[model samples]
Target: MCHTSGVSSERAAHLLRLSALFQAAPAADVQALAELARLRTLRRGDVLFHQGDAATHLYVVESGWLKVSKLAAHGQREVVLHLSGPRQMVSGVSVFVDNARYSASAAALEDAGVLTLSAEAVRHQTAQSPALAQAVIAHFAKRHVELLERFDDLLFSDLNARLARLLLEHAPPGTTLLLPTNSELAAHLNTVPELVSRKLGEFYRQGFISLERRTVRIVDEAALRSLGGP
Candidate 1:
């Protein structure tokens, strides 16, 4: 199980310095915002929220991981998004829009520490502070752009490319890949378990990747990229 630790004073201070999301806010305002947030812990596989459920708060992870996914009609799950490690916020877009129902569900991938701020509270604070308002707007804009990029990938990319990109993006730096269950990897890549299994076998035989139980290591990134084709 992944363990989540409370935000240390140094980390909290560092988060306030982030420029993209809260650039317009002054350092003092950022610090105040941090203070207003409440921290919570989550364990791996724990559901943070469910689809169609009321969206009340935005969460910022202090540590660990979360997967944001949607459930299909056939009882299949698709991972639509991933979230921050330390000092990164999750589901900011949904909360900022004042949407009552969540578009997706979030589950802890590991033990995670998060700070949650009620939408009402955030709105109130932003109302009195122009900096906070700018921050929220930036957050919304970023999420919109990210979703558009994902849409492009879904429309134009093949399954192998999609899976490779997901692995490279989420895996630890310098790590070739992670061996996740076919179902889990399929969900993230927007594919089916059977197809994923077949592709994995093909890649393994081609010397593009090495598979051990549930762990996958990329042996040839160039070869994997070739499978995506130009």
Candidate 2:
């Protein structure tokens, strides 16, 4: 279940202060949006909003993680696009575009807390605040670059290279990290779970990494880096 409630302006502004998106925004403008902010709490597996839903509110993650993904046109497949964590936008960029619907759905990856600001309220303030407007433009540009990078990775990078890069990103050499399941990994990699499992097994057999259940420790960082590329 999800719960929603109004939040104190101070609390909301404090959350905004923690995000780079609002860091350079004027204090008065931040307070204005903060006054309209609400708190939303979600349990693990709860859907924050569906794709194609009206983008009424912009969300900022306060705690835990959420998976932002899109379903295929036939509704038969899902591609995990991004993992949003604390202080990051959750289905937020879309809110800035006029008449935009959410292009992807967001679901809590774990018990999570999110701050919600009404889209109408935000746009109203944005028009009067050049600093806020500039910050939002920067944020959108950053996301656009990330989307292009992901497209490049998917189009040109082979699975071995992609998977190796993914592992290294989550757990650098000499560090052990609990990893998401193969299914989740597959969704992020835009592949099937069986293939993910097979590739992981191959990596283990090659002594590139040590796997204890889902926990992975890098044993050969040089080899993975070479395969993963720069």
Candidate 3:
């Protein structure tokens, strides 16, 4: 179940700090932006917005996880773009560009807190604050570069290499990563679930990784790094 709620000053400011859009701004500015934002509680599977939906606000994940994805044409499949956790913005450039519409869809991966900033509010606040403006630009640039990297992988690399890279970058030596389900991983990798399962099994056989219920433990970082090489 989901609901909207508010928090006290200390907690609200803390939540804002988690977001890259406000992480480095002055305390006063973050507070000002927080004042204008409304808190939302998202239940697991809550659809925050859909591709082609009118761009109304920017959302920050204060807690829990959010999945960002794009549906394929003919509606036969989807490609996961991101799996965002705490302090991350469901940041899209739509609000800043012409005839704004989200290019991808986002949903709550679990119950979470989100802070929404209306486009108009941000425009006004940012007009009066250069710091906020610069932070926004930086955030946009980061997200844009990530998109470009995803494109490069999809266009130039093979599926096994992409999967290896995904696990390698996200998990460190001997660390167990809380991974998305096979299906979600497939979508993110722009492949099928069977391929993901098979490749993971191969990784296990190679002594490069170990898998359990919802977790993947890195066993050999060097081997994965080799397969994940740029």
- Best candidate according to lDDT: 2
Q: Over 4 Å off in model 1, which ranges?
A: 1-10, 16-20, 73-87, 175-180, 200-230
The TM-scores of all predictions, comma-separated, are 0.75, 0.81, 0.82
Candidate 1 structure quality by residue, lDDT tens digits, 1-230: 33334555445545545534665576776776666666678887788888888888877766666777777777564665554455566766666566567888888766777777676766667788887787778767887898898888888898888776665555543553334567776766777899989988988898877777755677777775666554
The better candidate by lDDT, 1 or 2, is 2
**Per-residue C-alpha lDDT of model 3 across residues 48-149, encoded as one tens digit per residue:** 888989888878788777889898898788888878777777854676664588999988876778878777776777788888788878877887798798
Distance from true position, residue 99, model 2, in Å?
3.4
- C-alpha lDDT of residue 124 in model 2: 87
10 residues in a row with least lDDT, candidate 1? 1-10
Which residue runs of candidate 3 sit more than 4 Å off their true CA positions? 97-99, 168-178, 205-207, 217-222
Better of 1 and 2 by TM-score: 2
Q: In candidate 2, residue 117 scores what lDDT?
A: 88
Count of backbone collisions within predicted model 1: 2
Once model 1 is optimally superposed onto the true structure by TM-score, how far is the C-alpha of residue 84 displaced, in angstroms? 5.3
lDDT of 3: 0.79
Query: How many residue pairs clash (N, CA or C atoms closer than 3 angstroms) in each of the candidate models, in the order given?
Result: 2, 0, 0
Cα lDDT, model 3, residue 84: 77
Give each prediction's root-mean-square deviation over alpha carbons.
Answer: 3.8, 3.3, 2.8
Model 2, residue 67: distance off in Å is: 1.2
Which of candidates 2 and 3 is the stronger one according to lDDT?
Answer: 2
